[model samples]
Target: MKPTAPRYDAVIMGGGLAGLTLALQLRQRFDDLSVLVLERRAHPVPHAAHKVGESSVEIGAHYFDTVLGLKPHFENEQLRKFGFRFFFSEGRRDIDGVTEIGASRYLSVPSYQIDRGILENYLAQEAARHGVHFADDAFVRRIELAEDGATHHRLQWTQGGETRDTEARWLIDACGRAGLLKRKLGLAQPNDHDANAVWFRIGECITIDHWSDDEAWRARCDPQARWLSTNHLVGAGYWVWLIPLASGSHSVGIVADQKLHPLATIDTFDKAMAWFATYQPRLYEALDGKRHLLQDFAFLRHFSYGCKQVFSDRRWALTGEAGLFLDPFYSPGSDFIAIGNTYITDLIAHDRRGRSIEARAQLYDQIYHSFYESTLALYQDQYPLFGDPEVLPVKVIWDYAYYWGVLSQIFFQGRLTDLALLGSVRDELQHCQRLNLAVQALLRAWSGASEKRNRAAMLDQAAMPWFAELNRSLNDRLDDAAFKARIRASTAQLRQLAGEILARARDCDPALEAVALEALLAHPEYRGAQRLSAAPQHDGAMLFAVPAG
Candidate 1:
């Protein structure tokens, strides 16, 4: 950036995924506006063993592929993920004999196993190519946010033993967990989801499909490409993720409840190996054979957290890890990046047009926080149910249904910035959020009451036409009217499904107590609860397929 070129329109701190993506979005949205991104790390970051969060679900995938127009890079560089796969085998060595909960075939909506280093490098390069200055190896020594009514916030960074200063009207903190602004303002808040993570990268891919020799197990999958999936080896209060990267390395992680599997147990690499031996021995033996291929290992204690605020009226904002991060179980890191970046882009554009932005910023902050809280419900106080194959399968279906049905549709349809539309569907959206909280509570109660159904069978999601169609519908193209209608319909679908799930839980355990769901079902307006709910989706596939009398 030219020192004498006057102030930048926006200065983004910490050129990680969020910072670089914000820079790109700002540059793309306002071509003539000047944007500068500062990063402490040097570029061309080491590939393969770079960073965690390699998996991407629908929301994040749509952001990178469609919104950012990086579809070519996805096709050429990244590995197309085979959807989120989960195995309920806890202690047993044989994965084939366990209950698997994922699609037998690939879902129509595509996501990717992102190589973080590669993706960030591309973002930085793309930003620079588009005239947005991305400065690496620049340490932000001090951040002096603007005072009340101040036009610009001042920032100082050091590079090559020289300190430099600049000012910008808009400042965005995307410094990952560093939380430069979040700490400076004491915006950090305690999260209820106290989970820890220990992750490492292997030099080469670890194939799960080869773990068993049973011909029947081998023949279960059509293509027998389980290795391509973001395979989760799940247990009681923990789950191990095995993600294959296009960089020829596989990313492996163990995320567990702090109460169930403490951080001390898997803090170090050797401890991680030891934990694997106890919890996942088959994987342990595989890694032990090629221990020399271990590339990098790291751990995070209570990995999830929140910020008191992300966007501010003082012309500042925090994105990605600088903001609130719920959990990585569903790989939601990049998806938030997409949403935050989009909101920031709109805010900047609105300001440039001399529009009043304080109210909008406050509203956006509230909406984003709501999204965080709702997503957090999925993991908070719900880890104990992770190992319960019966409850977990239902939870997975409900979680994905909510994701694809509501959030994904809103994002995929680009209705995020449409404040009017969000307002219009306020009741429906609130109902969806309320329904999610209720469903999560009901699932926990059902898990506590129900007997452990240890059936050694795989419940293939793809085999379920309704589940497969829910995954496929994420790729649908809809006009403005159709998009709004689709979201409303999806909300209704979730409500109906939630009712059905509650009824089935009650049926299984007649004495089960689901206060929220029970109250809703008892309401005179709810007629379906008296009967079995079999809500058909757009594909006319029955979502709430209860047993026939």
Candidate 2:
């Protein structure tokens, strides 16, 4: 009699950030469930230059620090992020002379700059310590997914010149762009946002504080730790990111609209330098001396994509880049991974309990796609406003408010899969989504109508006490009633903020007609809260960008 394949509870393909985190989460939750992670790359991958996703925002930070219990590692091994900073220095070398947007001090909630190699290595050890069977250097060769719940899924992989086969009740693809299951199942879908990116790492840090000698400019940020922030040097249709790593190396990348800046212009290291020379000369000058320190150079054209389905009732799923990828402008790669892995883990839990997961899987997929679509709206066709100091600052504020007010609230409060609460606030959620869409359109129009102000001033994000409070509120553990009330309050806040944005845009450019936003504001159910006293007054001296003198 032929021996049957050994079966495990879960088989995770690819032991990168997504897979490793999922494995850790599963073991943490189930304790005794058998989980296997197959990773093509060997352990102890080289530090400082292994991957591009080094920055972490609120959701990703919470997932890593709180969910995975890696705060000690984060505090010790990673750089605590100083929040996002931006400089509208397109062609000039005097970066301080450009309009700056960031916080004056660290906000209430904390985030970090992750070193991918370091984090992955530590995650592997943690997952193993948690009793996950992690197999590094195992390349998945083939996957035969079970069509029904009755049969187990088959996974074939090779490691150390030996082939191995395993059967698993759950097969999860966290392959990160190899998209093994995504290709086999024909899940790849194209999105409208056609953007490109090229990133490489240098052996040493690129300190932005030392770039300018302006004493007043240098004194703006408390602690003068500008190097720790994810600094964005912006231009029309393009932005360059500077992210510092704990490994003493810095990650740098240029993300741009394909039509405005073709990939061919900066696909290679030499071409990137030349492109920067003409567009961001300061960065060009900084890197011109250290080209030899380039650790890795990789570029992706049309990087943003959609997946037809990620979670399925078939007991299979995709996470990380294996599913879909949006732009890295806000460092959302890790956040999506967190969200996806959570949904996948929840579905598995349901299945293990003998509860039907078909409907739950579909529901989670819909909700997940809703998130993807909303985030896509933030980036689609909005690159033209990257350099618009007059509009981009407001856009950034609105974007953060939306992120923190709605999505972050749900995730941070552990209400991601709370159906009853979500259903109760369904209308408000839909209204917020509509509000975001309208605001994005308004921003594009506002940018077109404005004079494109660029001045040497700081737009401090934490200046608004309420905004700082919102960031701080993420740490609060809310009961169901309080959570619902919070969601309602957040909806109202987003409505008021949207109204303020629209009003401000009209103040700057009266001809700007945002019909959809106006209609939404007109609705009685979603009216702007009595002119936000917390909001800065519309004076020349405010926390927003103003016309250059």
Candidate 3:
């Protein structure tokens, strides 16, 4: 007779960040729940260079710190991010002589620059401590998802050179690009945002502070910790990322639009160095001396993708990169992970309580995909405008407002599954989405028609009061009435910002038409708010001193 398979309430596949976190969340929410995490790689993975998602934004950070109760780990083991910093340096050696866009000081809310290896290792340990069954060095042999909701999903795997079988009420795929369930269910889809990326980790720090000799330029940022930020060296059609890890290493990568910078040009270390020499001479010079310190090199073509389905009534789901991935421009990888994991956990809870999750599954799927689509607007065709210092600065402001004002508001208020509140504020959320789409189109148009200013100046995000406050306001605890009112106000803020952006673009080129934005603002609902200016002035003064121009 065949041996009986062990059964669990939840069996999460590929116990990396997403899987491990889901296990912990489930165990945390329901102490009696039995959960197992099967990861392919062994535990205690090498630090600094093990993986690429080394940066966390507001949503991801909050999910890890607050939702999962791992704040202490982040505080002690990871690096607190100095916020995102950018330099429009292309074919330029003078790092301080380019258009800079970033905060002059850290914002009120916190994010972290995570070393994936360290975080994952720590997550594994934490999951075990929290009573989660974690199986490292496990290779999944096959998955047999139940066709009916009443039956358990069966998963087959190998560990210690022996095959094992288990049945689970909830089977989650957090396997990263492997898409174990996604591929089996024929759910893979393609997105039109064709881009490529090549990333590697350096064993030593690629400190930007030493790049410039100007004391004043160095003094622009408080604490003089530019090296602590996720710095982007941007140019036409491409941007290079510099993310610091806690384990005394730096992560670097080049993301480019395939149309302009072909993957072949910088697919290898030598090729990347040569390509960087021409477009990013300063960064190239920084890396040229650290060739021996290269910890890992990897590249992916057409990295952005979509999924036909992630949540299902059949009691199986896909989380993290297994579902879909947009660009890494804003480090949204972990944000999506937080979102998917939350939905999965909720679905499991509903099933455990004998509640019908069929309709809720479909609704949550739609909402999650809507979030993905809204964020995709920020990166889809926006790469072409990255080099336009003026337009990009304004675009960054709009993007952050849309983020902090809408989605981040909902998440921070602990309302991810608040279907009632979300339904009540449906109109506002949809309007916010429309405004973002229009603003993105307007930004692209503005970039095309403007002079594409690359002059040396700092567009200080911290100096903008509304921008800083919007970020700080994420920590506010709100009741239902307050949350609804906040959503309405946030919608109005987006409209006001849209109007200001449209006006600014028209100031540059009066002929530029922003029909969608104009039409949205013309709506009776948006008629009366005082237009709030969220961007800094064009003059290069006040926030920080520019080189004695």
Candidate 4:
């Protein structure tokens, strides 16, 4: 007689960030919940050269630290990011002579530079300790779904040369781009932002602060900590990123718009170096100095993509790279994973309680899709603006404001699964979403003709009171009503700022077309009297200063 297979509450495919985190979440929420994580890769993935999502932002950080109760691990095992730093030094070598946008000190909110191998290994261990069945080196051959909603999903995989079978009430695809479920369902959707990336890891730190021996320049920052940030070397159609790892290695990548910077231009290590030699000469010189320390190199063409559906009432879902992926410009990979996993967890919780999950799942799916669409608009047609000194800073400020003001507040407030709360703020949230879409369009239009003065001054975000205050607010613990009021005020502030931005765009050139955005902010109270401005003419004048030689 054949042996009987084990049945589990959840079987998550692809034991990367999404799968492992989900397993941990399920086990944490419900004690003794039978969960299985199937990972094709064996245990102990390589350290620094493992995977690409080495950078984490606010939401992902909160998920890993607060929600998952892994704060100690983050502080001890990983490097705290010093916030994002950008240098508009395209085709230039002198780092001092460029418009810089970054903080002089660490931001109040904490993020991290993760070594995927180390983090995943720790996560797997945590899963096992929590009683999750984490099967490494598992080669999944078949995923057969039940046609009737009452039956459980079944799958078969090989582990250590022995075939194993299992049945799961809920099946999740966290398989990255392999998209086992998505491919079978034909849900893969092509997006407009076609970008390519080439990345490698070096067994060393590439500190930007050390590049210039000018003591005056180094002293501009409070602690002179440039290497601790995710630094971007910007150009017209591409940007090179330098992310440091806790393992004493540095992750470098060249992400470019396919139409502007062809994949063949930077397809291989040699070609990438040459391409950097022309577009980002400073990075080339830095890499040239440490060529012998190069550990690994890889590339992917047209990386940005979309999916038709992710969450469903059928007890199956897609999270992370298994469903959709947008551009990696702002390091949103892990952020989206945090978001998607939350929805899946909520739906599973609803199902386990014998509550009706169809309505909740559909609503969650809509909310998740809306988030994807809004974020996608930011990078879809904005690559050319990546190097614009004047426009890019304003864009960055606007983007950061919206992120912290709205989405970050929701996550920080622990409202991801609060359908009732979301329903109550339906009108406000919808208006905010509309404002975001309009602002993205307005920024793209503004960036088209905005002049790049290429002023060589360091714009210290720390000096700007409002900007710094926003960063500080991330740590504030607010009550329900207070959080709602906070979000409302933030949206109002953003609306005024968008109007001022449009005014400046008109000031630069009278012919720009932004009728819709203008209409949204066409009230008389937004007139000549006084509204906040980040420019030098306003109280924000002291934000940027030139370093003495």
Candidate 5:
């Protein structure tokens, strides 16, 4: 369908995080551009509290503060600082060190244990301050593009028993997991096998006395601690998160796969608590025997969905989960929303300044997709071992380093234009994949050997070489200022190499592309037999997880 230029610059559907954030970005970037936000709910204020992605790693927090100009309020209301911490359920061991993965005193930044409803209300107010109009309780019936296709979106919505037609030059989909426009356009496709989640908030608090003597830990655990967040991997396909809010309350929830809890049902607070008791006794105990449940448990399946195209010839773009979602293990959900908002605003500004929207949109899509693919690879490699006690140190260190490193460069340094950052991320992801494959290979080789002998042999022969190299690389790079400088230089060079590789792929140089993909998949630090799988098609792309037998 064709689209005609409309009176308003953009119309944002679903006034949640993505919608309101994008609206604010658009208004901030272009003073004269008119933007309208439509929300289905009458008021976005918290009634029954809910927990979405509560832990915002450093980069996510940085984006919120620096890009959105929301740092001040976030610091005041929702921000907290803690060096990253995680627990392995099998042995409940603690691993601590100082590296990218073990940095001490990393800012917890401004992650929220916020009610989505309350957050949306604040976002609406912020958007209003930027001159974006907001309409609540307006459910959109359908969207029709104009005939000319010159940037137009027509929305049919029902509000107060009246059907109204709203038109805009651009339409943004921030409808989250609902994927309203994505499904309507037939652009939505599942990225991975269905993953389900059951999440709700509990009023109980979990105290960590282990760090009682550490000043940082003491502050974080204090009753007055406004932004306390903690997490633990319970077992395969299950994890728990605890987040403290400013209201002198905490939010607790568990996310697990249906396969892990086939009989678990969260119909009531008591049922949810009982399920937690069965699966995560420590967390259940930390909640002080009996805790108040804030809302009914919610399930999310088909969790990772993305559109084939994020933008159209007509005036429409996807943001947040409407565009793409991966596993929430790293709290990328809200980060993507903020990132998309920034990108969309930049595209709009370029268009207003006489640049080509199509070209900008294409570039935007490529960059976003590449980032998503790289991140997904990282998560996929880590998910299987999330609950393994033996690997707790590895997981904690890797996660902390990766999360804080990105946050430091992006937010603290304000270096978003550096493609090197993404390249480094790709490198880390590939390394992780290699480690996982090597571990699997060693396990299979030792199937008939005694557990102690096999474990000792594998540790000494198969894992140590790569583990040493990784440890050395991490320590060398993170231990000194010179190492950080070297990393930045190396990353720049790598990004240039990646660009060339991308060009080769496009030019149909299959052999060269294959070589590059192999290089990405091969980690010299890993010394073990290779697992059988298709050669990588893209440098940072994740192969789908093999289902458990």
Candidate 6:
């Protein structure tokens, strides 16, 4: 079905975080732009907890607070705050014999946890407040793209037991892993290497608060606890997450590689629960004989992918998971939604009245694609061996510090788009790709001393040079203070570098990197690394200075 004319400036498919956020941002940026969000599910009631990504790290929060200026509203509605925490069995001997590390909690002016459903509801209400229209319980039957090169899109949807059609100059796909629009456009692709996830919410379980006083037990909760205000269980090949809601209930589920356990073999929810019970005792213990399950378990495969093209000859663009996804280890899923909203709003606002829109769309595609690829590479390298016991603790600690101290701060403050960090992240991604190739070569040449020696030497050379460069970069970035003050300012940078290095270093020397991170973070001059000041006059930069005697 074709419409009489393009009825909307943009049509957003999917009402999840990504779609709703994009709608809100569009409304915020352009008052005259007619926006319509097509959501499959009925509009959820206020405070209803929806199943989706719950964790929001510093970077994610930054996107919401600084990039989109949505934090104030979120805080008013009860979003949770989080800090950084990591636990590992493999890297315990590095940081004073502690396997787990934590950073001080920080909020985005105002931050707290809210039901994703509630958040979406608020965004929808706000969108309406800004003159954006939302059509709920409307299923998109098909999307037809015109071949005339005008880049127009025709949408077919069912509402009120009647067929309806709508036209839009721009299309935004925020449909999540389903890739509704991508499939309609023949752009859906699989993420072959990633693990599958099957998760559900369960109730009346023993919460993390049950053991909060026990530092040892609480440390294993993973950082998501702080962000989502829940406890989680992590293990090799799979992980379990527990998110607390205002209703005193919890969201719990397991994610794993389907190849390891064929999906066909497990047909029932009981079977799925049993499978999780076998691998995750803690989760099972919490849910043992608990009240009825809240929701049926669900599975997601190929949760990561980017549209071949984000924009079209028309004004269409992809946002959120509709655009791309990486590993969830760092909770980049929700963050991308916020980021896409901001970027798209900027592009639309700055676009000329009637000039070539394709160029702007193409630029959006290119930039987002680059960012997606780079972030994906980072997770691919870091997540696999992050749990290896032979690894050192230094890198993990420092990595958290850097994420908390700098990268996260910059991201939430909307300053990541600038500075050398973006370039650095890109460079690090390329370097990791090379390292992966080298490691694979060594694995294939197993049992040959020549190959072994070559691999070792290459690794060793790779280690020292990059580590030294990282240290130098961090040191140089800090205010030219005395050794002590410089150490304080660079603590986050030092820890981040050490974490990256130690993660890839030989097990025997993991502590070497760990000790370095510890020394920097716990240096005498910087008793509380969190208190380090932001570099004056440098928007998003930070600087450390030595105190005069």
- CA lDDT of every candidate: 0.84, 0.89, 0.89, 0.85, 0.54, 0.52
Q: Return the TM-score for candidate 5, rounded to 2 decimals.
A: 0.71
Q: TM-scores for all candidates?
A: 0.95, 0.97, 0.96, 0.95, 0.71, 0.71
Worst 10-residue lDDT window for candidate 5 reads 453-462
Which runs in model 6 stand beyond 4 Å of their true positions?
A: 1-6, 45-49, 84-99, 104-112, 146-152, 212-230, 259-268, 291-293, 357-359, 381-386, 389-504, 507-549
Please identify model 2 stretches exceeding 4 Å from their true place. Answer: 1-3, 528-548
Q: For model 3, how does the per-residue alpha-carbon lDDT over 116-173 read when each residue is reduced to its tens digit?
A: 9999999999899999999999998988777743478887899999989898888889
Clash totals in order: 1, 0, 1, 0, 8, 12
lDDT (Cα) of model 5: 0.54
User: What's the true lDDT of residue 281 in model 5?
Assistant: 53
Using alpha carbons, what is the TM-score of model 1? 0.95
| Native-referenced Cα lDDT, model 2 | 0.89
Better of 5 and 6 by TM-score: 5
Query: Largest TM-score belongs to which candidate?
Result: 2
Q: Write the per-residue lDDT of candidate 4 for residues 194-224, one digit (tens) a residue.
A: 8999999999999899878878778888888
Which candidate ranks first by lDDT, i.e. highest? 2
Q: Candidate 4: what lDDT?
A: 0.85
Worst 10 residues of 2 by lDDT: 533-542
lDDT per residue as tens, model 6, 267-353:
456766676556554445556666365554676764555567665545556777776677665566766666567666656665536
The RMSD of every model to the true structure, in order and in angstroms, is 3.0, 2.4, 3.1, 3.3, 10.4, 9.9
Which parts of model 5 have CA positions greater than 4 angstroms off?
Answer: 1-6, 81-83, 90-115, 208-227, 263-271, 291-294, 399-549
Error of 1 at 204 (Å): 1.1
